[model samples]
Target: MTERPNMETRTILRVIVCDNDIRKIVLPLKPQTVDSLLEQLEEKLGLQYKFTLQFEDPDFNNSLVNLTDIADLPDKPTLKIVSLVTTPTPSTADTEILSVASDDPCHSLRTAWPETFEIPNFPVDVEYRLRQGNLQYMRDQTYLQLSGELKHEILEKLSETIYSYKAYPNKEDFEAVAAALIKKHPCLTQPGSSKGWNGWYDSLRWKMGNYRSKLRRAGCLEVSINGGKRRGQQPQRNVKRPKRFEINFLPNFPDGEDEASMESKRKEMVEEMKKRRLNSALIAQNMNSTFALRRKELIEKEPAVKNTVERWPALFTNGQKSNVNARRTAVLHGLPLLLGEDPTDFYKTCFDCDSNEDMLDTAIGIMTVIPEDSPTVPYSLHLDATTTAIILEGTVVVDNLENVPQAMCLLFGLIYALNLEYPAALKSTFDFLQRVILSLGHKSLKPKIQSLKKSPNAVMFFHG
Candidate 1:
């Protein structure tokens, strides 16, 4: 029998998995388009009803990226497959340096903001002018009224920051913020109005809501999810969010992982935990590598906490508990000065004002918590300047943190690592830091950080 010459056009590839259990297929012809390739994959992978497709690219250090264009496929490329429904949404410090996205594409947007009206800090030049503006207002009764350009620039950064937390802002959410803004700066109050900030409050309330409405109408899913469903409506409660700052909360299975591959890693972790001479390194690696699968169990099955702990006991260990994703710390050291607005400096710059010496030295009663579970523990986040230790409800858990940034970073990390929610007061601050600066866990920033990615010089910062 003679083979047809047309058969030479065929292509072969191996689905990314362990070498021992690789799934390989030869295509009769190279798929001419991305959709065609996806169709072929869907038909061949027996149990996969729906899937996401990624391929190794030498262009991205052999890291996998979504297969957007079939022509982008390299000859005989390896493909990583995962169910589309299970793309896990969402870091570590120095032992693993997060590479910057310098090689990734960057784009710009017209404006952005933080979720709250408590602006972290204005641009350095803006701050200076604001100070000057305040001094002048002392003699005359005028708030630090900004020029049209200055206001837009300021609000642009604020919009990016706000979008990180939520696309919508209501009166209850931002009114107090306006009051506090004028209170602190004094220069920012409008003299004509009895309350002093009617105009600013209106700007926040209407502007943020309008932005989402416009985007939703324009079918901008980035602001409104999927740009489908009803636009600009409040979501029913119980939308699943990262319990903490979980980076790999709902992530795609790792580059070459599926049920079997991940299960094997899980077993290996269990076996390693059994060993008297535990391999901490190997256990950590496996723990991190299996995050997507762990989340899949938690998200889809909604398993009892006890059942999960028994199956993966090692995961409940203190070491593993503290080892949650450090994605928010991703390239944190590389974070730009951001128009002289250092994101890390929020705590120091936060209360450095006309307050008495005691207020500046120690910020008492800043945070409080009443757990849903019984035995309500006191919720207090107090900073003792002299000892430089953080006291949470009468006990000192963290000590000698030395400075505010280190303490703040550790506190933020602990919140995520422990799967704790942000204190209601500081929720916006946490979201901005998580979604904007450091750029850790969670899917769909909703940066695009206000961002270093969003613009040449704008980043959001908030302090509680």
Candidate 2:
């Protein structure tokens, strides 16, 4: 048979003692004398000096009282232990006298109780008390090591406070939130090797911005727009005025008979005009010299022509019909060689193009020979130079195109290849490609064209 639990047994009480170090001790619930408790503390802690104990109030304003009985203390009471000091006293004759006996232990205890304990008659809000305690702890400890649950609770409280007051969390809101969090958990203020208030503030601001964006998306936030300019308000102009020349005119003679003086004045004005013209000419000469010097320096810095041609083959293309036609034929004929096949048919058909229409027909024919899964089809075009120009202009073709999609793809491929070879014409090529795509009314092909235009080859091309 099992023995029944005893209901009459008192629970153990816990007491925290703090001085130079912190310690906790368990005591029997049964009432004990203050002298016995002090003796047990001195013996168990191995303390050699005499000390006084005081209740550790959260407000830190509690008065120290003489301990009479251990039963008088509350459950889990916190206490501060302070070492006692004594000094000698002077007698009536001014002679120093030392007392051999120890001073009374209860002599320094205050007579009045702390205001917090004295206000038992009034009702108190628990939340208010908790906030005050947290603030007091923040003030006393440099860091408050909190558990995960406590940290979460403090963060939740801060979030709620921030949302309740404003839609957008500004610096002031973040400051308030930070202050509250620090008070609740001082460890947040000094997060060792972790993000501090500034990081937290930035995170909070981001969260607020995200929240605002969501509200705006949901049509819950209202935004105001400014109408043009206010009535009767003139728009400000930023016009630059031309410089005016100051000229001195000679005063007329009183008798109106001084032709000699008038002639001399006219001669002086002419000389002044001539001097101004000479100054202008000198300024223009200096500007022209500066420009020439800069141009020469630039030319010296330019890379060698051979290296440039090797790096950018498109720079070598003269853009003439004959040269463009020859290059396009060579590239087409080389495709079969890359595929490990005979290039006789492709070479003959590509080279036989005499007109723009003949070039388009040949280009379309080359596209048919290329396998559907060929990788080269994406990067290179089979179209000759003339065909590319015709496609860019959105001209109506006389030839009945069998595969329009393949032809369009070949056009884009040619553009890509051109950009790789001649980076100097990249912008114009893309502009032309855009116009062709739009004119073709093939919306499905637009994305492909755009993708080709945005490729790294096109992006890094030098328009210069």
| TM-score of every prediction relative to native | 0.34, 0.17
Per-residue alpha-carbon lDDT of candidate 2 for residues 1-464, written as tens digits (9 for 90 to 100): 98654544333323323211345565433336667667766665555457666552323222233355566565555554434531100110101111112221111111111111111111234344445555766677545454555544544444433433344344665755555444444445655434456655665666655554544454321100111124665522321111121000111122222445434433443343344232222222122112222222223345576654443232222310122332333333332333234422222122222333533423322322233333321112333212222133223232333332334445556656655332231333334344432343343444544555333222211110
Model 1 lDDT per residue over 292-392, tens place? 57766776667798999866777676554322222222222124223223222122111222232322433221212122332211011122233234434
**Top lDDT prediction, candidate number:** 1
Model 2 CA deviation exceeding 4 Å by range? 1-153, 183-187, 192-196, 213-219, 222-464
What would the TM-score be for candidate 2 when compared with the true structure? 0.17
Worst 10 residues of 1 by lDDT: 101-110
Among these predicted structures, which one has the highest TM-score?
Answer: 1
